[model samples]
Target: KTPVATLALAAETLENKHIVEKPDKLATYAGIVKYQSDHLSKQIEKLLRFAHTESGRLHLAKTTVDMHELIRESITHLMPLIQQKNATLQLNLNAAKSCMLADRDYMIIMITNLIENAIKYSKEPVIIITTINTPEHFILSITDNGIGIEKRHIKKLFRKFYRIRNNEEYVAKGFGIGLTIVRKIVSAHTGKIYVESVPAKGSTFTVELPGLK
Candidate 1:
């Protein structure tokens, strides 16, 4: 169902007197409303981002931002979803050089989108977020034990509205612009993104940006 239909159905469900009388049922329906509201809001935000990117209105406010700190903040922002999905994020942020020149807001969005993808697409969401600061670049990787992408789909994942659909076991959702926005943000930062995956195994998305050493 579309988000509007889901929201309407959830709202209608909340009107049932029996559900209202039961606290657990009431909470569940209410949660559906909140979740759908958030989902719709995120979709709208993505649309605005897409418009800005297409119109060349997307601009970056660069500053000395710490990649480690941004990663932590992104995790905190996504804590509710993590708990809801029973997901665990193991962090290995041993990057001696963590600072970079980038837009902090866009960085958070990029990080959050990757981490959220890891959680949403995986049956067992044990995501590992690792960071490495090489002499020339800062690498951030989000690895998940999810329904990995096929080699054929790897090249098209960054295209707007493109999603992996070969797996019947796991049906991924959303407007499919998440990765496109992520790629745009990375490009704006003069970074490169890569993915390594094996079908039915897992996938790792790595973003390499210039580090401020």
Candidate 2:
């Protein structure tokens, strides 16, 4: 969706003859189009790489990922969902000036899926994203004031096709593969994931990655 929207914006910018007068804006849009094209391509590769029955372990391209920018882009991508749930996002990253030597595409996908999952079941729908950078590890914590998970269910949360439901009807519309992918991505980067929750209260997911050298 982001790729499509960005592509459309690029097209509009190109089609507008008046845009030629603004060379700077035209150049910016052109760069946006290129980036989104690469982004779209990577998404397709991820699907084919992981969606196949014969697929093996994941492969990654290591690069410096700006943690703050990645988180901001993820929140931006989820704007519609946040608005639909009437949610408020409180972000705290003043101390998170951290970077990861990892796959940028995978990081974006993992963060986006995590936040989207939070929005799906949030009771009061207030999400708080915080980050901590220490000598040992860099942590990103997403806290949601949602219908918290049960003790019996927390352990199985990262399993593929795992869905949460108290009864017959499904709680959300999803393939339940999002977290599984996130877990795999984290593992590939030698990171750790933790979940804390209390029924009727809320949940928090914290991902800890080793500090960049």
Candidate 3:
């Protein structure tokens, strides 16, 4: 989303120039400024979290959480984008709801990033969010029918500031920071993330966290 950030900053600069001659443009300029401001805010939050994690200042307040409920809450927050894309989002959660001990804020960030990535990459009409219960982990998967990443790019998907090359259509607007934050947040929670993708077939990101009673 760095590209978006740059665009926003440029817009702000332009807006300042037009303040005297074209005050009417302030509304449009304000919108762009706010968009960039919010994106930067998220990045700052991630940076703070990473700093805490590295310094061992990050502490988990373990509590039993209903996975399905958490997923639903995430979907609700992302519903606007899903609707804007004219894409359908389906939740196929298991009948069983597992309770896990973890920090609630971190879990929200993890799930939000996954859903955001799915929506950003999808080109298809529908997206699926599902969960599976295993003896050792609670598996959550976000699958999208969008332009999938190539096999070669899969390895670097989690690297900070690493983004896929040659997809100008997708690269034009994003700074490629979402997945990095996602990986860090998952790792902080003592979980793992996996990805499967085909250039045209789409991609699935699965996250596994300890499922405790």
Candidate 4:
């Protein structure tokens, strides 16, 4: 209801106002609608699925997905955030192996969350996404030069609603369930995810899912 109302209000505002001359205002409103719509859609779908599933576990529908294309799609969805942070997104999708057997929607969610996670933690973050096919698995790495996770916290990062900072130490605020959902998505595909980081240097998240035969 709120999302639909917001959308209607935005459309009405655009129709009533003359933003044609001010490209900046026009772009900001446009971006707002896009962000709100995307957020509402993702949340609604998750809520619907949760309501439907008896076990509360995410259901999977396997299909052949190209990793390069998936990352590109996720990046497109995150343009507003990317621009807001003045962050440069680098993609290294040159690897020969790019296919994965997974659920497209869930993979997109997983990748989107991971990318957003990286963007928030890093200062003047340069986000690098690399994907390739390995002999036994498809490898996806998201590397960022940001404040790295502490050794103790690294192990508990996947725990639901667990946050890293205690008010003073954390710069950005989050619900802290993004990685939990990402972990669930990877686990559903029987994949492995790991993180390596140094305190001030940066952090890298690596995911390896069994390759399609």
- Quote the lDDT for 190 in model 1: 85
Indicate the worst ten consecutive residues by lDDT in candidate 2. 166-175
Candidates in order: C-alpha RMSD to true structure: 1.5, 7.9, 4.0, 4.2
lDDT values for all models: 0.90, 0.81, 0.74, 0.81
Model 1 CA RMSD to the hidden true structure, in angstroms: 1.5
Candidate 1 residue spans exceeding 4 A from truth: none
Q: For model 3, how does the per-residue alpha-carbon lDDT over 84-177 read when each residue is reduced to its tens digit?
A: 5677888888737467887777788789888877777666547788888887889998888878888889999988668775557554245566
Candidate 4 ranges beyond 4 A from true positions: 1-56, 166-170
Best by lDDT: 1
Q: Mind giving the per-residue lDDT tens digits that candidate 1 earns over 19-126? A: 899999998888878877887888899888888898884599999999999999999988867887899889999898999999999999999999999998998799
Stronger candidate by TM-score (3 vs 4):
4
Pairs in steric clash, model 1 = none
Residue runs of model 2 more than 4 Å from their true location after superposition: 1-49, 52-54, 167-170
Q: TM-score for every candidate vs. truth? A: 0.94, 0.75, 0.77, 0.79
Number of the top-ranking candidate, with TM-score as the measure:
1
TM-score of candidate 3 against the unseen true structure? 0.77
Model 3 pairs in collision: 1-174, 1-175, 2-175, 122-146, 123-146
